[model samples]
Target: METSDNATAAEETTPEPERTGIAAQDWATASAVPQYRAAVVDLLGALAYGELAAFERLADDAKLAPSLEDKAELAKMASAEFHHFERLRDRLAQIDAEPTAAMEPFAKALDDFHHQTAPSDWLEGLVKAYVGDSIASDFYREVANHLDSDTRSLVLSVLDDTGHGNFAVEKVRAAIEADPRVGGRLALWARRLMGEALSQAQRVVAERDALSTMLVGGVDGVAAGFDLAAVGEMFTRITKAHTKRMAALGLAA
Candidate 1:
């Protein structure tokens, strides 16, 4: 009878694993380590939301394409974006944050950014998609390793492979060869779109601590509050890549 009682007591007292997508141990360790856990969590949450929002925005923009063929290509690009978004959402769930909540803060800012600087024509639409997606892919790839192993693997897996080379430079080059004047205006528009995105991105960061932490979460114990240098490197890589993209397309500045 005492053995039976002991068994029941043991069962009753045993702790269950956490369901928050965060392990209690991992959470406790991460959370207790100053602001490390929250910073990482905030970043994960923000990024997950960003992916979903980009997918939706790109899908809407796809409709503005002038040609049916271009429209279809844009739609395909949007589909790919959603695929990327879903992977992010799944990873977010693993960390115990609601996808929608993660994405809410920058929704309006992202929306307005897209709305205000919407492509004036199909070619411009292509440029935005081509340029934006390329930069985003590169950024994600570089920073993906910063994530814990599971997340690092997840980011890498989602990036399987794609063709920015064909779509951006080749397509843009073909168009330019057809009509050289188009290059100048398209190049100007690309720069402007990039500028707007950068400004609003900073605005969004300034407004959200969670996002800022996530973006610059841990930095060699430099907890001086988010490493601007590391983040700037990501931006620098993006700018350099964009410059290369512009040169390939024969666009000035």
Candidate 2:
């Protein structure tokens, strides 16, 4: 099992043209086929912009914090997101794709999601941090299995929460403990977040042929692509994870 640092080192050792060309072509052909390359760029682009948006959203959320300590904590998470965005942007350039161009297709869909589900208060913001972010992370993790090694490692690295989710869980649980009534509202809010996320995801897949095909490409030994049964199971897995996390915070899924 190569660590992320080890994988990054491996990625760096390749010479320039080959690194950006044959190596990529060989990896894509052997794994996802050449056409999957577009999907890879789309994936990386979406992730990069998502992290940048998260940084901005978290910074905005920090301003609504009740105390300096809380503000500082959110600020730290925001900073981490910015760093992740930088990594994804660099990865885009390494692949000879324009970062802005790759990310452009996803901007409207993501922006719409954020706008429609904008957090109404501190609790809502915290819930979005956990529920919304985790949904995106889970979807990416599913896609990562079909990616080449370097991209897989980069995706995994960027998705790491660095205990930010735990912090949200702790704060949310404590609030629920203090006032049981808050849990009901948050639960509803969480459901809304999930709905909006799924809606946007469906929209993306419907509009983006490459990304949709990649998901259904059945790469990595998936014999049937993402067929109905497979997609159903995927949703089940995501729901299970969401439920488990919510339970950990003493909230209903």
TM-score of 2: 0.84
Native-structure RMSD, model 1: 14.4
Q: Which ten-residue region of model 1 has the weakest summed lDDT?
A: 1-10
Off by over 4 Å in 2: 1-32, 219-226
Candidate No. with top TM-score: 2
The models' CA-based lDDT, in order, is 0.60, 0.75
Cα-lDDT of candidate 1: 0.60
Overall local distance difference test of candidate 2: 0.75
Quote the lDDT for 230 in model 1: 70
lDDT of 2 at 23: 29
Candidate with top lDDT is: 2
Candidate 1 lDDT tens digits, 212-232: 554553432345465678778
Cα lDDT of model 2 by residue, 1-253, tens digit: 0012211222245343322222233444543454567778888898898999999999999988989999999898899899999999998998789999999999999999999999889989988878888878777776665566677778888987645677787888899999999999999999899889877777776676666666754443323343656656766666766776677667787
Q: After superposition, which runs of candidate 1 have C-alpha atoms over 4 Å from their true positions?
A: 1-34, 159-165, 210-222, 226-234
